[model samples]
Target: MTTPAPTALQRPDGSPLRILVVDDEQMLTDLLSMALKMEGWEVRSAASGFEALSLAREFEPDAMVLDIMMPDLDGMSVLQRLRQSGDDVPVLFLTAKDSVGDRVAGLTAGGDDYVTKPFSLEEVVARLRGLMRRAGTATAGGADPVLRVGDLTLNEDSHEIERGGTSIELTATEFELLRYLMRNQRRVVSKAQILDRVWNYDFGGRSSVVELYISYLRKKIDAGREPLIHTVRGVGYMIKAPQ
Candidate 1:
């Protein structure tokens, strides 16, 4: 999964990144609010779907963390309403269900990503950061948002990656994975860290996906060339400039 910005990202106008958190539970809302604020982001939490909708229109957040099950309109319904009105803000769904079908439904309902309930605050932050990365925002100083390691280059604005002057096509997931690896560059990031930053989940029933994507990246990035992506057996993975 491509990781989001290594540095804090902000609005084009040089304002703090605006985030909206929508959930029914007051304590959870507060906790999420605090976590988001600690990121130096401007946050507004809504306790109900109605309040969420209201804040969404008025606040115009860059991204949102929305609970699937709410007391009034429900998260899905709220999302539908927003889509109908052309509010295309990126959303990270909060769900209590771990079923594959349910998670698929959330994505099908237009969620950018999801985290099952009983989630860690860090997961939410990482997911939202990734969403905004793809959603398009400005860096604080607006430096060119391109990453390079060896002859490989990944362009954030264009969603493009190139190697040795050749353009390479990548699926959304693959791009995310590569982006994350490139951001950390030479550091040996473990599977647990990759799972949190890339997949938006903690370690458990999932892990093989990390290896899976690493191979995918190797095929596209390191194949037939001086290897840049490597596996440190018994540890995790790292991508580096050809030595």
Candidate 2:
């Protein structure tokens, strides 16, 4: 119900991002609310699908995060209802199941992307940013910013990623990390930089989470393809089309 501070421009760390979180777990929702607030985003939460629908109209968030399984009204149904009402707000689905079929199903149901359970708060933040970016909601006027590397293209507005003529499906976190790398293409970015920018953190700087996420990204964005995200030895990461 509270609106964010009006600003002529968005702040990097303090930009007021309005987000709605739909999940049945009270504990998880509380944790998410706290984390989002810490990042300067205005957050509203609903514990069920019906509640989400009610809050959606009232809050009218810039983006929404939905949990797949719920009592009474499920996440998919809630999304369908929203779309039926002509609301195009970007949606990021969350689920415990990480199967390929489940991922594809969520996308097919009109979700922008899906994040599996057991995810870190950092990953969730990155995913939400990616979803907002893809929805053309990152910048004022709802215009998407283009990120490119040679022929590779990432449309933050359309949630579309393409290389040559092929399209790729990237998780929320992958999309943000890829966008950041592409923004600084051909330059080596240390893990510290990546963590700070993409994950918005500055503590315990020795976790392997970044590496694990990079591997996940490689499978989806690189793997059998010309590697775009490259390891920079004992430093961090870099994204450049193989030359």
> Which candidate should be chosen as best, given TM-score against the real structure?
1
Strongest candidate by lDDT: 1
Tens-place lDDT digits, model 1, residues 1-243: 343355667887888999999988889989999998988899999988999999999999999899989888899999999999999999999979877677778888888888888989987887787788777753535667788888899987788899999999998889988888888888888887787667654547577988898888888887899998989888889888866
Clashes of each: 5, 1
Residue 81 shift from truth in candidate 1, angstroms: 1.8
Q: Model 1's lDDT to the true fold?
A: 0.84
lDDT of 2 by residue, 170-235 (tens): 888888788777767878888877775666443365648788888888887776777778887997
lDDT values for all models: 0.84, 0.77
Give per-model TM-scores: 0.77, 0.59
> Where does candidate 1 have its weakest 10-residue lDDT segment?
1-10
